[model samples]
Target: MVPDTGKTLCADTIRPVNLPEPVAVREDAAGRPLMVALGRRLPVAAIEDCWRVDDEWWRARALSRMYYDVILGSGRRVTVFKDLIDGKWYHQSY
Candidate 1:
């Protein structure tokens, strides 16, 4: 389950969370992702959160949104979600 810091920490007995297939980040005029934007630009705001849920695990890709939070950057604060199926990442909002 997701801890207080929003990190997924499955204990010994629990199965791993499923995630989505990885995706690439294209610069389409929008600001870069936090990972890429970290060194190059100083985020106007910066925050972190975590999640850990197990749903639809029987399906090829079955997971649920445990929780999310707003992280502000130099450009804007976005809500990020972790797809438990394939370990992919997504933005909740602009």
Candidate 2:
């Protein structure tokens, strides 16, 4: 016994979440993030952690990226990654 609702659920109604977005980043000689642009330039205070992921080699579009968890000068923490394949930077959050 449920009340009638005028909404229908289908594939069209589904949406993805937490998708990564492109970002501008400046790196040091060692390829460490020195600054990131999130509307404005934010200097990286420290790198909390770093890792690399290289997977799906069998697939046509393989994934290879270097991820960095950094703390900004303003005390905000963020996660950014550099696509090793395409050489582009993106920001993402868990």
Candidate 3:
């Protein structure tokens, strides 16, 4: 169950969403990741929630995803995802 803003999640109904696949990447000489990860951490109150979803179970190339609804330091809402099979991270926004 999802908890609305200012509302609490029901303890007995707590479900463990599958955490996104973890990935490791070194910073480029151009410092892109520094501009991507640290640059995208959320603010204190704006992040509404995180969601997880998986798809393509009927196909060989399924994608398992976990999305984070993050309010960036700049007040922009962004979504980040992790790819389970290849262990990589990605991001998007609406």
Candidate 4:
């Protein structure tokens, strides 16, 4: 469970939120995903961490994702994930 530190938190229940959003991304020459656009193009001030999850690969609808914890230019921190199976982006919050 995500700690509630005066910020939005994801509940323990596993719900379906399969919505995908289009975000403008800034990348290094090596093509690493850097800045992600929340509303406007914001530089990635810092990437707190990152991780990958691969699940249900045997099923027809599989789950594969790469999640990043980042602080935006405006200092708003958010957790964003890239859908590796479909190459899309999404933000998670309460």
Candidate 5:
């Protein structure tokens, strides 16, 4: 036996968490991030890692990005990425 609460589960009711947000990044001549604007500008201390992702190329809207894991001057680590298709920057957490 089961009780009906008049509720349903569907994709429409689902939402993404920790989706990347647009960010302001200042890059050097070599196209490396020097500073990033969170609330204010924060200098990048070091680039710990870098990688690229190019997926779903057969789709109408493909995904392509260059990701960087860096340490800020305040010793906080953050992940940022450049959208290769749109030339935009974003900050994300993994």
Candidate 6:
């Protein structure tokens, strides 16, 4: 769970909210996100958690997602992931 920040999210629950517009991201040496473009470029304040999932390998389009739970410079928390299969980034919450 995330700390309370006055957002609508319940302190003990996470929900998926797909990005209306996917943003471009700049990664650090270890391939962790350092900045994200959401309306404007916002630096990542910290990464709270991370994990990976690889599925549907036998399908024509497989799923290889690496998700990162991060806090922005403005103190807003978001979950973003890289689609390893397509090499793109998207913001989501779980």
User: Could you say which candidate leads in TM-score?
Assistant: 2
The TM-score of candidate 6 is 0.74
Query: Tens digit of lDDT per residue, candidate 4, span 11-89?
Result: 8655667455566666668444578877787888888988989999899999998887889888989777778888777
RMSD of model 6 against the true structure: 8.9
**Higher-ranked by TM-score: 2 or 5:** 2
TM-scores for every predicted model: 0.38, 0.90, 0.49, 0.67, 0.84, 0.74
Candidate 2 residues 1-94, lDDT tens each?
A: 9987978889998989889999999999999999999889999999999999999999999999999999999899999999999999999967
Clash pairs for candidate 5: none
Error of 2 at 92 (Å): 0.7
Ranking by TM-score: 2, 5, 6, 4, 3, 1
Candidate 1 structure lDDT: 0.46
lDDT of 1 by residue, 1-94 (tens): 6459766656865764543323332222433334423234433244455455677768876766533443444555545555544545554433
For candidate 5, lDDT tens digit of each residue in 12-32?
A: 999998999999999999778
- Looking at model 3, residue 35 earns an lDDT score of 23
For residue 26, give model 1's deviation from the true position in Å: 13
Model 3 alpha-carbon drift over 4 Å, by segment: 1-35, 38-46
Q: Which should have the higher TM-score, number 1 or number 4?
A: 4
Sorted by lDDT, highest first, which candidate order results?
2, 5, 6, 4, 3, 1
lDDT of each: 0.46, 0.96, 0.54, 0.77, 0.94, 0.86
Count of clashes in candidate 2: 0
* Lowest-sum lDDT 10-residue window in model 3: 26-35
Off by over 4 Å in 4: 1-22, 29-31
Please write out the lDDT profile of model 6 over residues 1-94, one tens digit for every residue. 9678887757679754654346699999988999988888899999999999999999998889999999999898988898887778988744
Residue 55, candidate 1: alpha-carbon lDDT: 77
At residue 68, what lDDT does model 2 achieve? 98
Which pairs clash in model 6? none
